[model samples]
Target chain A: MAVNKRETIAKNIARYFHDGDFVNLGVGIPTLSANYIPEGTEIILHAESGFAGQDGAITPPWDVNDREACDRELNNPKWADKENGWKIGHKDICDASGNLAILSKGASCFDSVVSFMMARGGHLDATVLGGLQVDEEGNLANWMVPGKNIPGMGGAMDLVSGAKKVIVAMEHNAKDGAPKVLKKCVFPLTAINCVSVLVTDICIIEFIDGKMTVVAMAPGMTKEELQKRTEATIHFADKIDVMDIVEE
Target chain B: MNKVVDIRTAIDKIKSGDKVAVGGFGNVGGPMNLLYELEKHPEINHLTTISEDFQMSETPYNQGFTGLLLNGQIDEIVVSFFGHKKAQAKVDAGEVKLTLIPQGTLAERLRAAGAGLGGFYTPTGVGTVVEEGKETKVINGKKYLLELPLKANVALVKAYKADRMGNAVFAYTAQNFNTAMATAADIVILECEKLVENGEIVPDQVQLPGVFVDYVVHCEEVHY
Candidate 1:
């Protein structure tokens, strides 16, 4: 069986995150990769809420309250002493992680100007976001749907502009079975020319020379097959690679 | 000390056809006084607003001011870009014109305008799709990209606290581009929630001094 879109996108994001990199995760499916950074990989997860090194999965429990925290910090030997650094609350950890941005000489609350400045100032190394659509130019349009009324645009815009490397992780198609990788987005924009890589369920796409270059694929999905489902032209790489591991 | 009512009236003085630059990154914090007063000016039109991202979905940015974007206004917008769905609709409807800029370039242009620079060349957009129909200059045997300065007639800034002198501070995440915007605008109007006494605000705590601020409207009716 072919690897699922979720696994494919998960692994694609793993490529950018090696070790000792400051990374920020968005709210949607991009949040799924919290525990999938691979074994022996050193990555510091930065939660905007203030967590610097918190780690955990969104507790999925069918028996109890299924909705749980998306973060967890295990008592790993390398992270902290077994007695010193135990399993900590991700929310508490993120909230404790304050940056130099917060120690500004003046201004108290979070303003748009300072917020965007931190983002635009390259505070975070990598930002993994979700998108409804990504074009050949690697432009992402995940904020809205054309006709469907929805919620307000979230931190996607800030994440895109400020993060050093922008990685989008999403499914291959829409709920109605429409291709999300399109020629152009039909909804309002969040940010323009900010997307760096398109990590989708079916394939891994990146903007090389202002065009989408397919560098990897789902286990069994070929470039031609991935293109068949996507409405936009598929710019395939000369060779496609296999995904590394499953999302833990 | 003007009451909340007078502050709202002061905001009402903002007429239509005003060029404004709002200080807010996404939407967490904004000048509620200005936004509220803008609601009264339904007669306002052809407004050019410069903002970071999601801060402009409200009334003044919604209807009163003409968007200088690829989607909002009839004229033109110089911004990093409108992302996702909104960009598509604006492009499809052919309602507005858009000039997209790289995030760094846009921030720098705004910063350059604030710093009183004519223009700067960066190798960022060079040799990529971002380089199209732009003047290319060779400097020191290398190609550099060029973008113009982003100046505004008026800049609207949001802050957490302020002194009677009109100095303001920004909240976290919301302080994206306020200072650069404050310098670029001809008249920088600050919308502050907390206004303390002149000496109440410490000199060290002031981010933008009252010298750059033209008007100070308190946050009387702003939603938290």
Candidate 2:
């Protein structure tokens, strides 16, 4: 069975995430991956706003009645959520005598000190980032598009430098059809040899010894077919096989 | 007695019937040492505690509100997000009385109370049902206000560093409502991790001056 490029990319990512992993989903494509995350495994998502141990939908239907569903349970917990979530809301009300205490579940949030400490201290198991250019040496060029506009580096530097596993999700081609996976990135680099795996629409690219290695390709896409689309040098694994996307 | 005293003697100052305001937002700027000390002494009881989140590890609301509940110390708790299933379950079951406030309003109210203004107007809980029976007035005939005062009996603050004279500098979230709250309280207690020499803080960096301070509980380490 032949699978398309995007579908194959999603499966490869899902394969890496196991149950109970504390995954920080960055804003764009990384954030959408949560929908595809396998349930019952509890990949707790952390948002910057200040919710802790939260996994339910962001805001329930706006009706006053539906407001009660604000803190519904989702599976698993992030590293920070496990310790101080109770501190995120009213503790006394939670222990009130007659009323049932509803624990406010915020699957997304960050403690100012602890949140940054964890990111800086290598507590996050994995962080998925987007990239403007990913060079052969696994150098990540993200924060800016080289002199477009600098809107302060928002946690990208910390996530890039600190996360144990840095997974990147991006388009295989630029707007001009130029390949984003490059031999040498022209933009300012965020971190060197940081990206662990590249999940693109076309194939799975891994940074091996300062070069691009294609571990897996789309089902219908052949070796020659994959290289043609990419403008840069792409290393093809000798025993490369089609990804098991459809089966999953 | 309207006075600010040293925290080493804060236990003596904090009575059973005091409503204390703690500083911190989502556990960022809390005075954990003072609270921890208050817990350990077990000298005082029946406290009406106020603040954003009571983040004790054991029970979601364990160390806190329970002290208020079992002893009947807390008559009422004003907070937001207390309705998060676990805490709301307790509220609905009749164990405690929870007066829910919107998040931003809670902080501003604390600030207002600290600043000594009787009440400030806010458009937060207006019109859509949050404004239930509270006196809603029109300002400049524009239909723009609800006035709620900031009130607290005692304030507990945590800081990164403090001078022997009592100036404090906060870490990330600033959670300085506990600081503003200090102005409103008869008693102000500080649990500091680092106590520097007097005149250590430059005028620019000093957040809360010694004039508002009464007691200092010198300590090392935070409750992480």
Candidate 3:
């Protein structure tokens, strides 16, 4: 079976997770990494919006009678269902016990400043972020497009620059077939020399000693094929390995 | 000091052209009731808002700070992420002025203001557009940009619980910028979901002490 690029990239990035690692996942493809986190390995996921443990859909326990009130209060139709207690969509949610927790399963929260302090002070072990463009020097440009109305950079700059290891989880090519891995980024940069690993649908690229090295490629893809799709100069390692695709 | 006050009375403290630093990452820690009340006061205009981001979504009730921005109560917004489509359109049409600061810098600048510091240097935006027209100094061999402290006339913050004395605690990720904004403003108004006795909250769990809070308002419902 053919693997989806995003899931492939997310699974590839998930391999980097270990027990007790503090990881921050960026909005898009990187968020998927949380679902593929290896079992028995406890990794803490950090959201820039000030969450530390979990991400994605959270279902809070609610009395059947309180469903409408929850719906009316949360302003989300997802919570309007009478059968399923309450289903509100939030970046983070708390429990009835008054602890800052994620209902996605379980998680903890802290003051927002403490979260950013961990992000800016290099306390995070690794951060998985989607990128618009990554250069040979490991520079990233994922925040803004010149002259566009895209929301400004939130925590990408701090996460990329402060995390011990920065991983780029993105598709190999743009929708228009342009390579996102470029010789030079036309988009405005989020941070300079921050990316340590580039995980794409087709291949995995690593920056070792300031050089872009191809460490693994997707099944049925060749180094030449990935090189054709990438605009940056791609150098292969002494031995190339097939990327491990974990089936969910 | 007794810091708990009625929401209507707290809203009256804001004046026209006041620089208001609001706490929130979108609607997470946003003081929506205070912002909503401030919107009704048409006399309050030309305000400058400092925050981490604009509204997270376009939901009418969850508008939060974006409600003030849409009502033209805010003339300038200093934030890290300014990408709300409606607000961005206003910025493009020259309706609102935006000053984009990196998220961490935004947090640190507010923190510096509360800590009573002049400014601090950071290497986050050295060669990017963020460095334009900013003071750059090299300490050792690395270049750093001097980011001044951000202060405001009034700050609106949201917390999960507040005691009678105004010592506060915040909910999960909802505590985003509230604690920092609480100390960076001249008058800090906290909107809380739960109100307790002065000593009801344990000392260790108190995120922002009463010294920094000026007013505490009990919000009946969770706005965000």
Candidate 4:
């Protein structure tokens, strides 16, 4: 059976989180990293939308579509009949992507001003975000495409600039098969020299001593295969290891 | 003094081309009733709208900036995130001038305006388009971009509860930009789900003081 690439990458990224780390997970593949956090290793999740310590997300059909189907599966009929749909949590409690969130035990919420203060004030231990392009200089371009797709930057700029460690979790290449780890980013940059680590489906690269260093590769993947998929110039560490893909 | 007023009276204070700062992370603390009232007054056109994000929904009941955008009222918008597909189309078509800022900078700009600061320096947008045409300074050997303060003519904020005196208590994450926006605007109008007597709310628990709030209006509870 083929490896679940997304889960594999997420699991590898989760290994970076230490116990009691205050972490922010960007939308898309980065959000999946939360589910792969090793057991007994707790981390506080921060959402720039104004909250921290989110434990998990509610299962979708965020809105109740088929009443009969909802009634058959859900243990609580009341949750299935709510106006916002069969949500395990409150409608107002959501991540930046508007997915209903199930907060952790000690979850606390605040306004955006203070929420961003925690981000810009250098309180976050780490933040994992998606990337459109990452350059050899550790520059990341994930916010906008200019004249094409301009979904605003949100808290990405602040997160990358302020977090103690910045991790980029993304696929190795663009959907069109172009290498995303580029020699230079053509798109608008989110931040400069901010990415500390990059985790892709096939490899894990970290910026160390001002160089893009490949420290790990997916099992059965050769350096040449990864080099072909990456556009940025990278150096392999003397002892490269297979990335741990097991969930536990 | 009592600050409670009817919704119409509160919204009527807005001018034709005033800059309006709305408080919300999407619609969490959005002043939907106030924005809906503003939308009904098509006379108030060519306004500059500011918010964290403009969330678009097909649901008619959702009183987000989508109505103002569709009504062709907003001439410009400054936001951190805008996922409204139709609004983006309008932006690409050269209808609305969109200025995107980093989220932390957006919040700090509003705070700086409220705090009466000239501007602040930060490293958020050093090598991006945000640094273009902006002052750059090297502090302690690291480059920082100078960001100016952002103030507005009026601010519309929402709260879970408020006293007639305008002291407010926000519920959950609904306090997103409301607190900062209240202090940054010339006129601050707040809509509340519940209204209480001046002495009912404990002073220590007040998230926003009455001094920053100009008017208070009771609105139907915002569902989600």
Candidates, DockQ? 0.09, 0.02, 0.50, 0.65
Per-residue lDDT tens digits of candidate 1, residues B1-224?
A: 42223455555545556667766444434454565456555565456566544333334432212233322332344455354455446545665445555555656677788778888776545544457787889999866667788888888777778776777665444455567678888877777767777777778877777778777777653432
Backbone clashes for every candidate come to 47, 49, 1, 1
Global lDDT of model 1: 0.59
List candidate 2 stretches off by more than 4 Å: A1-248, B1-8, B41-43, B59-72, B83-90, B138-142, B174-176
Best by the DockQ measure: 4
TM-score: model 3 vs. ground truth: 0.88
Worst-scoring 10-residue span by lDDT in model 2 chain B: B56-65
TM-score of each: 0.61, 0.47, 0.88, 0.93
Which one is best on lDDT? 4
Ranking by DockQ: 4, 3, 1, 2
Instruction: Kindly indicate the candidate among 2 and 4 with the higher TM-score.
Output: 4
Better of 1 and 3 by DockQ: 3
Better of 2 and 3 by TM-score: 3
Candidate 1 lDDT over A1-248, as tens digits, reads 44456765676687788777877777656666865777888776654432344444433212111113121222233333444443322111221111111111111233233444555458788888888777665666776676664343434555675688998888878889888888876555555677788877667777878877888776677767888889888787787776553543
lDDT of 2 by residue, B175-200 (tens): 32456566666667876778877877
Q: What is the C-alpha RMSD of each candidate to the true structure, in Å?
A: 8.9, 17.9, 4.9, 3.6
Least accurate 10 contiguous residues by lDDT in model 3 chain A:
A95-104
Error of model 4, residue B166, in angstroms: 0.7
Rank order (by lDDT, best first): 4, 3, 1, 2
Q: Write the per-residue lDDT of candidate 4 for residues B1-224, one digit (tens) a residue.
A: 89999999999989988999999887678888889889888888899998998866655546588788889999999999887779988898999999998998999999999999999998888898889999999999989999999999999999999998899998767788899888899999999999999899999999999999999999988665
Chain A TM-scores of each predicted structure, in the order given, are 0.75, 0.72, 0.80, 0.86
